[model samples]
Target: MNRRYVVHVDIDAFFASVEVLLDPSLKGKPVIVGGLPHERGVASTCSYEARKYGVRSGMPLRKCFQLCPRGTFVRGNYRVYEAFSEKFFRVLHSYTPDVEEASLDEAYLDLTRCRPLYPSFTAAARDMKCRVEKEMGITVSVGAAPNKIMAKLATRMAKPAGFFEVPAGGEENFLRGLDISDLPGIGPKAQVVLRMLNVQRIGDLWGLPRPTLRSLFGMGGEEIYLQSRGIDARPIVTRSKPKSVSRETTFLQDLWDERLLLAHLAYLCDRLTLALREDHLYAHVIEVKARYSDFRTEIKRRLVVMPLQEMGKIYKIAEELFRELFASSRLALRLVGVKAAELVKSRPLALFEPYSERQERLGQALDRVRGKYGFGSILTVRERMLDSVYDFEPRRGFILKTASLTK
Candidate 1:
């Protein structure tokens, strides 16, 4: 049987490391990248020193400062990070054409075909890590295994700047001693539930019957059981486009009035529609997501046979869905979101019949103006209402405007 080899590469403390590279003085000090403490923002990433001080990613800025008063805090620069990621991927491409980017800071490379190119998997991993650190001024950790699951687990075991290899046929042994949380798909809730079922380790899960596990956690339990034994059949797909475009907001204080909620939904639909138009795409499905004070969440979706491009049309559908889903509920809302799915490339000019050439021209003109001046250059009345309600401001960046049309 032919063996499959997978390699996982993850940059160490990506944002914090970039900060260190820019300023030599911050090398050994505790560094934090997040928003201002007064703003309700959370830490994006922090240095190992900051972790020692009990500061972690996703912690509120105020708590981070309370834990480490002297920690250096810097606002995250996403553009710089994006540039670094591009350069890093270039180096990865040099090693294998079968590289799959897991995220901005992590990637997986299939080395089954190129195993003979290097003396061994360990050597290949070492060389890759060295090239990234030397060329990009960033450290990376690598993990090698016969499958993606084992490769991911190996990477976690070799954290804080190191490399590890799980030898062929040794995956189960490698995972046997690890905590249940070490499994990729197991979250805190799953861990608690598993503990209640008297399963404390990854090995313990292997003994449970698949049906019993499925009964407890549904389809996800079956997935976890397979993963526990390093049996992930998911391939690294090259092109994975998003099924939907969405925007969401969580209120610091919950709102109770139905009118106010409807207004917010209108604002979200406007934003989502603008994004859809910018992408040169239209959606046939509109989904509205709402979270109540009791932590219960609901999503209601409606499908249209014809793709919708107008903000008014999309918002009307979303409002109707929301009203139908929450008509009797009087609970305060914690969060609200709007999503557009079932997308297709916009056909401004059609062959089957004559369409509204004037509407298409207007959309193109508005998109050009927004592209040049920024998203705030063009806004509907609903977005203006959002500004009044939330004091929102648009940032300067590549808004998905006319750019998509050219592509």
Candidate 2:
């Protein structure tokens, strides 16, 4: 039988490194990507030079500025980042079919079946990492071990352009002396609790009874207990579609006007369906959210018998939900939102299906135009009211953050 081997690859400071690669002038400088320091947003990633000033991903740009005032800040271009991610994944897929995309910058590969072709697991991982760096002009850290947990941790151990491998029987030795804080699931709170218990190292956690660990961390404790001993049975999950996609915005002022609210709903639904169709996914569950002026929030959701990808169908259902929710109390709203969930791939059409073929074609047409001209180039007559509300820019869409997790 072949031995199990999982290789984890992580791009080092992916966004920051890409910025440096795009413009060599950024090299050796403290680069922070995500937003300008004067802007209202968080840092997506930063160069190691920025890290010296305590900068980090998800830290507010204002606070990041306070830490590294001289840092070069960039309002990152996600489309470029995504293009690089596509090339990065292609390199991983060249190695094995079983590649799990952990995020845009990281992936896990099951290379056990292909072991016979390589001199050693480490050699195969190193070659793959080197190819990514050479092709993408980005540094990558790699890890190889018998299980997923150890493999990922090994990558963290060998970060900033390095490689580490744990042979089949060496998981315990590889994990033993690592700091508890270095473990993925052990957050700051866990570290405090563990420090109080004198469990400062991965090896220290291994000696504690499983039940004690379980009592400390609840259901996740079992995972922590197993991970401490370099045991992880989680399979490589490679699903590219997310479980849900949503778009929402808070009004600058409370709104009692129903027509304007519907306009907002239509806009949000349009954005949501565009994301769904891009991924070749459909959703059977539709949800609508509304927050009244007094801080009361409400939502209405339904599960359909059949799934759909067309925006009109989704908006019709969403409109129904919003009307019902709005009529329930007829109060002014501070925010409105829409969500599509229970995602699945679109099924092949059967002969003379009962679905709306025209709506489907319309959505396809809209998607094609949006692909070239931009999403806001054309909007439904209903949603056009937004032009009067905000400083509308068809190509760039206004300054509203839809809280859109497009992926």
Candidate 3:
């Protein structure tokens, strides 16, 4: 049988690394990108230097500052990150067209066909890292294995800036001594659950019967079993669409006013609708989530007869759901989220009805104006009201201009 090989590549401390690229002096110094000490946000990413002080991504910004007072903090620049990501992918495409982008900083490439192009898999992996670092001024680590799960695990073993290849038929040996969390899809919550059952290592996961594992993890257990033994049947999908699109906010202060909550929902719906139009997709299901002051959460959803593309229509449905399921008065809400699921490519022909055509024209016009001038050059009344809630940085213009051209 022809063995499949997967290569996982992840950029090192992506946002923090970009800061270092702009200022070489910050290379060895601890760097963090996220909110300020007084801000109600979390760290997006932190340098390894900062990690030494126990600073890590997703940790609250206030906590990070307490941990590493001397660390430099910079607000994240998504546009700059996106620009760098394009150049990064261009280099990867040179090696293989079969690439699956796991996120902004990580991807899995299928290089089985190009194995003979280089002297060895390790050499090809090294060359890939070198090309990215030399061309983009960014460092990446690579992990190679016979399948995606193993490749992902291999990358964990080869952290910071390194590369490693798991030998074919050595998947079991490669996973034997690793913690359960070393396997992909095993998150902190899953690890805690597994530990409760006295399963601490990847090897221990294999000792449990498949049926029992399934009972423990539901559908996810079968995936864990296959992955623990290095048996990933999932192919590298190049063009898989997003399962859902969502917009959410963590309130700086918990809110109770119905008018304020509605205003925020309007803003989120507009943002979500704009995203759907940009992706040329539409959603048939809308979901709303509310997290109370005590962190108690409730979700409400409704399915539409037809996929929707208009912001007004989506917002109306979301507003109705909010009113029906949530206490409208005197309820402290810590978070609000809007999600659109059951996506499909928006069909132009199907959108020829009068209402749909008008929405399509409006969206196209707005996009054209934004493309020519800029994103903030055009905005709805509701968006302007909520703009102050979002983080603002003046340097964002430079980053946006640079990324738009490259993308």
> Which candidate number would show the highest lDDT if scored against the true structure?
2
Clashes by residue pair, model 2 = none
Each model's total of backbone clashes: 0, 0, 0
Pick the TM-score winner.
1
Tens digit of per-residue lDDT, candidate 1, span 125-215: 7899999989998788899998777888898888979899999889889988899988765655678999998898898998888788768
What is the TM-score of candidate 1? Answer: 0.63
- lDDT (tens digit, per residue) of candidate 2 on 1-407: 45689999999999999999999998999999999888986898999999999999989999999999999999989999999999999989998887888789999999887866877777788899889999999899999998777888889889789999998889889888999877765756678999999999999998889789869975346547756777554445556646678998788788999998998888888888888878988775689999999887888885443466778778887887898889876789999999987677764244213567677778889988877887788889988876666554555554445433222
TM-score of each: 0.63, 0.60, 0.62
Off by over 4 Å in 3: 185-193, 240-407
Candidate number that wins on lDDT, 2 or 3: 2
Q: Which stretches of model 1 miss by more than 4 angstroms? A: 240-407
Those runs of model 2 whose alpha carbons end farther than 4 Å from true positions after fitting are: 240-407
Using TM-score as the measure, what is the rank order of every candidate, best first?
A: 1, 3, 2
Q: What is the RMSD of candidate 3?
A: 13.1
Worst 10 residues of 2 by lDDT: 398-407
How much is the lDDT of residue 198 in candidate 2?
Answer: 95
